[model samples]
Target: MATCKSSSRTGLDSWQSRKSLSECLRHSLENKMFTDVTFKVGREQKCVQAHRLIVSIRSGVFEAMFYGPLAEQDEVVIPEVEHDIFEQFLRYLYTDDVTMDGASVMGLLYVSKKYDVKTLEQKCLAYLSSSMTPDNACVILEQAHVFDEQELKEKALSFILENGYGALKSSGVTDLCHECLVKIIQAEELEVDEQAVFEAVVAWSESACRKQNKDVTDENRRQVIGEVIKHVRFPLLDQKYFAKNVVPTNLLTDAEKVKILTHWICPNENVSPFNANKRTGIIRQEKIIIQRLAGLCGFGCSCSSGADHGIMFSVNQNASLQGFQLYGPYDRPTAHYDARAFITDPTTDDVIEGSSVTKSVSVAAGTTTYDVEFPRPLKLSKDKKYNLLVNINGPKSLYGKSDRSTVQDGSFVCSFFNCQKSKHSNKLNRYTDVDEGQIPGLMFLV
Candidate 1:
């Protein structure tokens, strides 16, 4: 006797099979096909009818409530969970998917934990981690601390460290718990300078002190900062800043203030550097060339009307030419296409033989500032006038507004029409008439 081949072994695999089955079950859920239990949730007491077997299989709390001891009851109440969250939770049980925003994740995570649903709990944690921002990291850290989620808390803390200045400036930082604030200010690695860190701490303490209805005096603020003050690297602050801005403040004692000022001005004459408490970011330079915009150019598409615009600047030292910034609207599929950057000599009006950063474009919503970096740094010479030239094939893709009235004002800005080759004639290339006063946006850093 012949047997049919196993559908599980091929296109009809377990994943697809489960997806189709889940889709059918989800449709059934909407129609209330086999729902046998009703859940009355929130203060409004909204009613949600769901299949008992589906809920029992997906959740331990529901399984025990509907099968173990209270099998006879057909109606269940969940006043602790809001109706929107509960509905999404039930929808997940039937469809195997959950949609949530930052605000709702907390409540859903709580309900998921109460129901002993590990999958939803993990998803909630991941979402919270991804959603962390400079403005929200402090508040998210507080919530993570309350939930006892070590991983989420660490991620939030890292975000605050990376965006230390912004995080500290956020209004939410004032509402952050004392321990959370301490953890942030005490971090051993912050991307911002020590002075910015100190300012942020002082701001946060002032806000927190006011929130507690405490006076904003120096001694009060010192007490508010607590152990966090020890982490501030005062010696890293500018000497003048220390004398003018920090010394006048009553936050530090005379001796403590003297110690830091002395350490900065006369390091060997005083006590040793505060190495143990000092937090510093690892030294690394991005070596990116930041280009400021002169004017946006919007050329209409025509096969015969090819034009290119560029900005000219002189390099002061022997260095590598890397990349430049471009600003344009993100409207077309051509936005994904790679543009070109080339360098040329201002005196000779010839393309620098090997000076080109190729394939430097990164695709994004092209409407904002796009930093195009070269595959490798192209070498340049000191005292040499170089033009950072760019060309985009598509029309109206590269353009900016200009308010300058005369061609003489836009001297550094140049343009060429029908000059396809890098070695195009000097006669064909002339100072662009659009806006000379417009600051050249093209900047290159070695």
Candidate 2:
């Protein structure tokens, strides 16, 4: 229809470049193979520059060459483009619809941003949000936040905060959640009362905060506190695993606290222990509680239900954390118990059980492992050192061949430990680990 700004009225500063560029493009396109190309605009006089603008192909797209002529909404042109982005752009120009895969669209997001192509930027943001892993989501969220794509930043922020300490406490994301919470609070410049806070934080159930559960559960209690602590989260990427065995849930015993600290310190698919929360803030802190918990713990009492949003909790022995975590290979030490050994806390150079405890277990490939898991509810304190040790008795004791080989011991004592007796009456125990294709003997302490 009509254009946003007439080039003649905007001044003739670009006249020289526009003239030369259009002439060069017309010269280049004259000999190209084109049967039926739309070239002329009815009302507009067929100027030399206008003809070049319509025929010139950039990154394989006719639209890139003659962008936003109808309005100011789409005038910017991106220069740094790969041949493939050009191809994709051309396809979009011809079809007006685009199918973007992860690898293909990542570069386009930068390109879109560079060109100020708001529509394309939004599309790429959606694509990135769907394709990202939790770890990658965290990284992307930070970048989106920095770029000030308000909508995209909000989406990424919600995904990053989707889960809280309580739901993942025993589920292995405690530390990660704690870290994200702390960062959000600090970024908002909120004040936290450290002494008023304690380690035993009890946030709400994950499903309780879900939108689908909104009509089912009265979240007024969570809502009032949410205003103060800002605990809303986006469940977009988090729900991907909701239906898979990767996210196991026992509704019958869902109320138990978690020993999820080691999860944050464990490696993820990208390798290296996931310090996802560290990317946001410190783990197991009150600021984390206030932000993620919505001051739920501080509203009334640590144990008060429906009144306290995720706020400060009464400090207790239940010390656990949660967040986006990475867990991969474990160190092969000796396995002590025939059952799986889990280390609640992950620390390096910490002596197990205050002694030089040495243990290793041989693993049976596809059958066994001394992998650690949470069998009980636990909460963690902030910046406190806690040791989660796994003891192995001898070869062939603890092992895992398939990751599904995980077993939970209900004694609430799945951890392997060494209780060194007095030198006069006892002997130091040494355990050995044998490789059987199972996960190696590993100890993770948070």
Candidate 3:
């Protein structure tokens, strides 16, 4: 009984000792007690204090700097690192803890990497991953490239591609380096139209010209962009839009414009230098069949008055919405109808811009499926509810049964909710939920 009591007392003392040491170290760091080294940091050369032994013990780079054969100076100069950032780095060494947010995390990451502090570096990366958004992705990608952080670079690139429109529009895009900008424009998986890509490149060119101390003229803009402009996929741009918008600008040469026009006229001929291949995000479509219809029974939804009929659904992963598949007339072999499709954020009650497509569709005989495609792939974020509404002028069409609310296809999962309908005069101003509606499946690319 004496031996057991002694062992328990020893264990309790050890735990208390460890707790006391941690508190003492934290207090020492806070008070700058027994600090043996001084650092002149940042362009202003502000002085900061730290303990050499604690810093060396925590960081291999500091150990080498302080104890290696070249070790001599008690004072270190780091003109590139800010004073507050150095303080954060020293605090981590002393307390093994860090407080970071979006604004300070990047600086902390740079300092941690310089000092070979693996734990702090990883913590910074984890913070960045959680807080990444389209607005800052370009800036993050540029910094990741500078730091040679391959994993962070890839993550930033993926986020930019997934949210191409938002990222391109962000002011941070102009801050990207030339090589990084080229990589982004050349990516086949980028989910934005070629016109948007062109506009982003133009914006970058203007910024680059200003940095080079050159006038922001058409010639200077073209010169700054250089070879990056070749990746714009000029042939993929709409012919009318290209003629009206692109031709007016001096960015493209007469020869280049002629080549693009020739390709449009004779698409089979490889005359243009630019790639005509459609971005995979636009062409590689996958259909999520919420419910397949047999075309045996006519859908009961009223379609003659040109009322909008649709469904509300959300995707489990980031994707581009291509369009939707709706059924045609039940008995008629062929029919002509004016079809319009658009998507809206049901939460905000605002229609997503560039999502609306209107065209006259002719449903051929022997086919019940009518494909209505958007003018461009609409960007859809993961787990956000969007209403896909289509208005068709025709008679009764075939419909399907909705036995399940959720359907999983490979890496993609789509969940369907209530059907939505709106009259032509009100036209998406408001939607009334219908118990039964007629959208068969969603066409998309993940």
Number of the predicted model whose lDDT against the real structure is largest: 3
Model 3 agreement with the true structure over 46-159: per-residue lDDT tens digits: 877777788899988888898998884867899999888888888788778789987888899999998899999999988887788777899889988998989999999999
Report the number of the highest-TM-score candidate: 3
For each candidate, what TM-score against the reference?
0.53, 0.30, 0.65
Model 1 segments more than 4 A misplaced? 1-53, 70-80, 129-133, 139-144, 170-176, 206-221, 239-249, 269-278, 282-446
lDDT of residue 19 for candidate 1: 58
Positional deviation of residue 357's Cα in model 1 after best superposition, in angstroms:
29
Score each candidate by Cα lDDT.
0.64, 0.33, 0.77
Give candidate 3 misplaced runs (Cα > 4 Å): 1-19, 72-74, 129-131, 286-446
Ranking by TM-score: 3, 1, 2
Give lDDT tens digits, candidate 2, residues 110-209. Answer: 6566545566777888887776543355445555655666776566556544322222232222222333434543342211121111111123233334
lDDT of 1 by residue, 204-267 (tens): 8788789889998888888888878877777777778877887777777888877776666667
Q: What order do candidates take by lDDT, descending?
A: 3, 1, 2
Error of 3 at 213 (Å): 2.3
